[model samples]
Every structure is written in C-alpha cells, then in structure tokens.
Target: MNITLKFLLLAIFSGVVHLDTMVFGQFMFSRPIVVGPIVGYFFNSPQTGLMIGVILELMYISVIPIGIKIPPDATAATILSVVFANIRECNDLGMPMSIFFGIIFSLVYKFTDIQIRTLNNMYLSWVDTAKAEFVEKRINLLVYYGIVVSFLRTILFYLIVLPIIYFIVKNVCVLIQYCPVKENFRDIIYILPAIGVGIGIAHFMEE
Candidate 1:
C-alpha cells in the first residue's frame, strides 16, 4: 500500500471517528469494534487490532468516565498506536505498546480537559451575545452556535492534537516499550480481564 494513501485514509478515519457527544460518548470510540479494530483494519492488520482491542477492552472495561474523572482516551491512542506499530514492524509487542501509549494519551486528555470546558464556555458566551443581538431569533442563534462549536471542536482537536499524537506514536513508541514498568504492565494485561469480568458479574447481580 502506498504510504500516502494509507495516511490519508487513516487521517480521514481519525477525523470523523474521534468526535464525542453525549450519545456517542456511551459507545463508538469506547468499543473495540468502532475505534481499535476499525483502525487496525486500515493498518492491514484487523486481527492484530482485534486481539489488541480485546485485551484493552477488558483492561478498561471497568474504568468509566463518571463525572469529572477523566479516563484514558483509549480510542485516540489505539488508532495511532496500531498504525505506528504496523508501520514500524513492532508486531511482537505492538499491542502492548499501543496500550502503553493509550495511558499517555489519557493523561493528555486529563491535562487538557479544563481547556475544553473553557472553550465550551467561550462558545456559550458567543451564543449569549447573539441572543442579546437578536432576541426574536434566539433559536437560530443557538443553532448556529451549536453547529459552529461542534465542527470547530472536532476539527481543531484533529488539526492540533492528532498530528502530535501520531508523531509521538511513530517516533517515541520504541522508547515507551523499553520502560522499566514494561514487565509489570504485561501483568496488567493478564489481570485486567479478570477485573473486567468481575465488574460485569457484579453489575449483573445488582440488576
């Protein structure tokens, strides 16, 4: 496959799939089918992506993003990490490396969450300003703001953060693999599923 074509397809997939809303928040990127395996498919390694997703899916299954607690953005990390691993020929530990990067990606999400909130506030203020200017057109004002905010948020995030993450995934993942904690993290790869299953059983019993 031509590198340019592969990158273009990945970029388009990344741009469209990464956006989050209340409903999409529940699934989409959070699920293996949508984010990880789908990205793996683009990488010409759907089975690898699926295997990695299964491991990651179990690992993070219990860690819900409730309230202000920012869980890792596994979706972003998985897509780029899988792509990088595939391209760089890190098949031996590709998935583990992807999960490791996922943790870092989650941390980035945490650090920048306040900024997103501020952006939301700023966008809301614009809506308020419009409402004041056109009292009779309040509905239109809000609609405009919603459209603008949604599009800008998605596009801007991709334009800025996605490229940065992609660069790091491509260049720095090898370093990440050699960390001292690598062995311990492999242990988590085993334990995470048991924890996920426990959570599932607990939820089932409660219901």
Candidate 2:
C-alpha cells in the first residue's frame, strides 16, 4: 500500500477509535465485545479482530478502574495493537503480538492522565476568565484549547510510537516466532490472560 494511504487510513482509524475511547473511556472500546471486532472490521479482518478481542476480553474481564486497581487502559491497548499491526505489515491476527505493544503505549498515557488533571487545574485557575467567556458566548477558546491539546497528545503518540512498534514486531517478533518452543510460548501467552480472569473472579468472590 502507498505510504500516504496507509498513514491516512491509520490516522482516520485512530481518530475514530480515539474519539470512541474518549467518549466511552474504558467502558466500551476497551472490551472485546466492542474494540476487537470493531478494529478488525476497520482493517477488513473481522475474524482476526474477533479472535484477538475474545482473548483480550476474557483476559481483562475483572479489570477495575476504581480504587487501587488502576488497570491499564484497554482502549489505548486495542488502538495501539491495530496501529502496530498495520505499521508492521503483520497478518490479521496481529493482536497476539500488538497487544503487548499496546501495553507499552499505555504507559505513556499514565502521564496523560496527569496532564489532564493539570489541564483541569489550569482551567480552574481561569475560573474568572471562564465566567467572563461564558457570559460573552466565547466558547471557541475553550474548545480550541481542548482540541489542540488532545490532538497534540495523540499525534505525539502516533509519531513516537508507530515506528517503534513496527520495527520491534517485525524484527524481534519474527525472531521469537522461529524459536524452538514457540508453541509453548504461545500457550504461556494465552495462560496469563486466563490467570488474570481467574484472579479477578477470585477477588470478586471474596468481596
């Protein structure tokens, strides 16, 4: 595919996916029921998306965003997975590989949360200005700042990350794929998610 076309599609897909994530947060786009099949369909690989989504869905079933749980954001994970797969030219089943990269991408977002809180605080500092603007019907400035900052954050992630995931998955994962115990490794990959759910359930039962 042409680089322009690929990047364009990636941007559009990422934009839409991010918008959904922004709207629903972790509630919808992060789960298998929505993110996996949705992203797969966007890439014209529904089956792969469904399979990956199912695995991620089941794995994170007990993830809690509240209290001390602070689970990694699954929405970011799914978006980065699809983005990595495309960037790396991986097969449709790239979720098996890319989901791991998504986790890394999410670490950047830990600071994003802090940035957002900072923005809220910044806005609070301008409460008097906000009141004046509200009375003047000048919502454009607020909208402008919100859009610009949000877009900048997402764009920074894309520029910094897309290439890294592409390179690593292509080179490193390729090497791993050839290892003697690849299947055993795959079994271990599947097992961690199963264990996560089991723990989640066990924790739930205790409550």
Error of 1 at 10 (Å): 2.2
Question: Model 1 segments beyond 4 Å from truth?
Answer: 20-30, 127-207
lDDT of 1 by residue, 29-94 (tens): 546545777888776788767766766666566657788776766665566556655747343555
- Residue 62, candidate 2: Cα error in Å is 3.3
Residue 110's lDDT within candidate 1 is: 48
* lDDT of each residue in 1-207, candidate 2, tens digit only: 665466556655555565444433434644655776777777677765665666666666676667534466666666666655554444332456777777777677656755764665566445465666474444556555666666556656665666666778777566766678656555454554676577668877984
lDDT of every predicted structure (CA atoms): 0.59, 0.61
Which candidate leads the pack in TM-score? 2
TM-scores of all predicted structures: 0.66, 0.73
